[model samples]
Target: MITRSERTLNYAVLVLFSVIALFPVLLILSTALSPDEIGAGGSALSLEFGNFAEAWEQGNFGSYMRTSVIVAVSVVTLATLFSVMAGYAFGTMQFRGSEVIFYLILLGIMVPAEALVVALYFDLRSVGLTNTLVAIVMPQVAQSVAFGTFWMRAYFRSSSREVVEAARLDGAGHWRTLWRVLVPMGRPAITTMIVLMFMWTWNEFLIPLVMATDESLRTAPLGLAFFQGQYTAGTSLLAAGAVLVALPVVVVYLFLQRHFIRGMVEGVAK
Candidate 1:
């Protein structure tokens, strides 16, 4: 049904946007591989693979990467579990004040994290959690859970009621139905949520900057900032560090892109 002109126009737009998005990434890769420091003209193309090794050692990225992985994994795991449960209840079960409670939780998605971060910092400090991984992980977990619950609730609400009835008829209780029936069928949505949460938690900067004063506890992005500040003259190293920090996210997305896209499309349609 589509005209040739329309198809061409769509391809043109996609190519344009793709270039816009990829230009910076290509520049970074170029800079990272250049032997000389990047300048206004950007780094010259070369095959300096040693830049990554140098950046890794100089930036102390190993510890930062380890910390980031731990925090991201912990936050995503806890947030997904909690969000699935809360979303199921809100989507399927009726109880007193349930709407009110769900609305209150939804307030979290409405509010910006920047607005609450200052107060959250003070609250964590009061509890002696500042300068700790727990401080960063906890806030991000809460934030991720807010969005995850909202996302999963929509999925659950749109799920087939006949399936739930069948599960009940098979003597499956609510817990068993959720874990055995719903969860298995919800792989696309669940994987999408996990990927989203992982990216957010991995890329988080402000909370870690505010909460983590100890060098050992800094996340990869925070460490990259410090590395940038210290190695302003080492352009290749800086670009390499940036790539290293971003690699995990890129790798994860590539692996789960199919499920991620499917989940997003289905969620939107529902």
Candidate 2:
């Protein structure tokens, strides 16, 4: 019962917003492609593919990227596994003080890292974990678990009880029921959670900055900040570095976008 004019208007509005959101990305890409002398405002007619190489080498992004990958992968894997177990428990099963324990974990989501980073630094330092991969990965895992538990819990809560009951009737244990059944069925939701956790873990700055003083321990975003300060006059290099730091997350999202969108829509619908 929609009119053609209304549909057209909606399309026009969507196009406008899309362009607005994409503008900064386009600008950064253009600037990254521009020559050093011409800077950000310069034309991309002269595409400088070498800017990325120069940025990569000069910024030591090879090391930063490796660190980011290690941290992100570790955090995502741990957080997702823990989140699934916790979410499945909270969403499908009941136990003593379950609500209370779940609410306590939820506090992590509400608390800002800025408020805890200083204290967290002392805690890690006391344990002699500062400047170590464990320091970087563990805190992020905890942070991610908070939100991941919440996300997966929603999906599990609204999951098909009939399927679960059937699994039980088939003599499938909780472990079998989860891995053999619900996990496969909940792919979209789990994938969405992975993408989100990867993004957040990859981009985290404050905790990495405070906990690690080792140059090799710097995450991509922290490296970018230092790279920016060092390359204040090198706009092309800065833009290229920005793109490099962001490319992994972009690639991840692009690959998982279908599942990501489906999960979001389903979550909302449910």
Tell me, by TM-score, which candidate is best: 1
Angstrom error at residue 188, model 1: 1.1
Q: Where is model 1 more than 4 Å wrong at Cα?
A: 1-13, 36-47, 258-270
Each prediction's TM-score versus the true structure: 0.87, 0.86
Model 2, runs deviating above 4 Å: 1-16, 38-47, 258-270
Model 2 agreement with the true structure over 63-176: per-residue lDDT tens digits: 889899999989999999999999999999989999999888877787778887888889888989899999899888998898888888888999999999999999999999
Per-residue lDDT of 181-214 in model 1, one digit per residue for the tens? 9989988788888888888889999999999999
Which RMSD values do the candidates have, in order? 4.1, 3.9
Worst 10 residues of 2 by lDDT: 38-47
Worst 10 residues of 1 by lDDT: 37-46
Per-residue error at 61 for model 1, in Å?
Answer: 1.2
Give the clash count for each candidate. Answer: 0, 0
In model 2, what is the error at residue 37, expressed in angstroms? 2.3
